[model samples]
Target: MRQQMLNNGQQRIGKGLQLSFVLLISGALIVSSCAKIEPVVINEPAYLRVFNNLRFKVTVDNQDQTHSTLVMLINPEYDSNGIPAGAEIIGDFLVTRNSYAPPYPSHIGNSLDVYNPEYPGKERVNAGPILNGFDLSSWAQVPSGQHRVAFYSRPRSEVPFFNLEMRYRTEPIVDTVLDLRAGEVYTLHVLQKDFNTKENGILLRQENFHKLALADSLVYVNFYNMSAKGFFEAPHTVKPNSGNHLLGGLNLEYDWFQEGIREEMNVFYVAYDERFLRQHYDGTIKPLASFMTHLKRDTENPATAPYWSLPLFFNAQDSIRSFLFQEFFFSRPGFDATPESFMIPNDGPEGPGAGGYARLLCYGNGREEPPAPRRQNYVAVPNLIVTTHSGEHNPRSFATVNSIEIVNNSVYLTTVQRVYEPPVY
Candidate 1:
């Protein structure tokens, strides 16, 4: 089977079959906000600024299970036949900042009205909502970076709701660039700070509260080998029901039959279904307070890996026409805010939508650009930054400055090009 498939791959490569795919990257940036100061009482001030907007090019893989398997089966139960269907995913993910900021308002309200800290308040009427999910047609254009990207997911019960407590995996911050395509779900959540604007002002700051999802059913990953000529294609699919089967012990055997294959070869693929178990939906999986809590506790059991593995699949075929099928089934429907439902309260920084950031920024080079993404083409999560006082308010206008340059964790004095001063409102 392997020999036949490899031969088929060679032929496909000869024909230049471009195999489509996807990947995701996470990174961070250091930014400082400059706010106008008015004579006011003092406190330990932390400035809220627009850090670079993170650009993640997510590429979905068919074999790399370690990073793709966000959830896996623990202990499973099967009936007379073996058919995997459901399992709870338990693992941690990382979040990072973007290199470019989208056209969205800062969660903080505009100057005329103050944003409410507790509630998001009414979304602005004039603002057009920005879709924050996946874009497949142009996954190859994302640049490289070093930082973290936030991860989020909706629960099985609440398809319309986001920000499930299981969202926001924080560890494993730094890594290589990511490539993303269709037939995958990428969660993006934001984190920012909010301040109490004096007055009956309603304010909103981009907090880590909002969670988003990029629901791409089939993404294409492109492979490059400068040394090799022609393009090759090998189609595969992520087994949504891999580890979780139906009432019997019967699991699904993925089948691929193409037009060019010889009749002598069998089309059977072999990879253990370990991603889900029936017990997950039956209330056997325990929910923890957070993934960090799971990581902190010490436990030894060979049955469980220290972290959850990203789910991936392997496909075997000797045919040239069978295209890959990647899909995430929904027994329930997904929800999103309409243009009317997406708005920021008055009194905080105006969001990109309100400030005319609803479309992708034009990087004009005299080239005709692609069309805008369709509304149904993407998903967005509303991120809200939250804050609480940890120390007494210092009502004095005194300033303290410190500087040092570090080389290999060692510090040295250096001249300053700019000084950071917090915004005082």
Candidate 2:
């Protein structure tokens, strides 16, 4: 009786042990079936901006013609199944900006305008809209490292770049690689090095767009000499024939610098013409800013190499406690209404533009020769004297400037302006 009882108890214990093992396995399976997971993808970023300054000469119907219009394409994306997503248009209808001042006002119906009750949409408009400004809300992000870039000439028309036919992409003016560093900003310039040879290429330069310290009254600036090799030469100054089929025999009478107008010559800064040369010869006048031809491009880091500075306001208060302001850079030539510096390059004063200046008593006046730029004309004309202030009511509202980029005598004043202003200060 005792042996039979022990055997039965042992059998029961074994059954219980088997049941516990099965339950433990089932519990683990249940937990494994309910497991959760989350996956993510992160892209390292670098910044790049494009400028299509390509004014290259192309042979059209056996005639050479120069154009500034360009369409740029960066690394296009592709899907996982080896299907093309689309070619991204990094830059489209990009032409070198002629004059960046007195920005094209945004009328009432502009899409970018906001609601202002006091200043009705119809009553007042945004006075300053940038010329070919980029969206500053977000910098163009790309994975750091090498990027293939290409520039093609497209028709200057209402059509978008992608809608254009395959003919436009047949001939790429500039196709190159732009190796960028992570967390760095850059500007890719498509340029024509020489009009004679039409040597087209790309130049990538690291850019610094941070505003300078706004504490003191100052106007900050820097200079870049992106002039072509044939600048001031005949090949660049003279335009090729567009409709000279009638002048088949007399080819000498082709369209060339007609009406005393020249292109891509010396760009004078302050006086625009002779003051630049005279200032160097005699120490009578020093320009607020001056850049000699063949000026070297800077490769220094932005933080270390700050911009050149100029006074924002002139304090001419003697005893009456009156504060004066400068209206025109070249208010009256030779007079100190402008900065104490007046001399500009003898050939141009470095044309900022053709506004705000008149022929004010200098070598350029009373000359019988064509109004074309002279080699050493004593007094020069000014493009315009730069103003320190561009605001009406706010004294601290200094003229907003980001970069003064010059390419083929076309100046681009790029501003990283804020598009939206919150209601509260």
Instruction: Assess each prediction's global lDDT (C-alpha) against the native.
Output: 0.19, 0.40
Q: Judging by lDDT against the true structure, name the best candidate.
A: 2
Question: Which runs in model 2 stand beyond 4 Å of their true positions?
Answer: 1-42, 56-67, 76-85, 101-139, 209-216, 235-237, 240-306, 316-396, 399-402, 416-425
lDDT of 1 by residue, 37-150 (tens): 464322322112211111111346522111221211112222343422222211212112222121223332544433211111122222212223311111111112222222
Worst 10 residues of 2 by lDDT: 116-125
Best of the candidates, TM-score: 2
Give RMSD to native, each candidate: 32.8, 20.0
Residue 44's lDDT within candidate 2 is 61
Candidate 1 stretches with Cα past 4 Å from truth are: 1-42, 50-53, 62-425
Q: What is the TM-score of each candidate against the true structure?
A: 0.15, 0.49
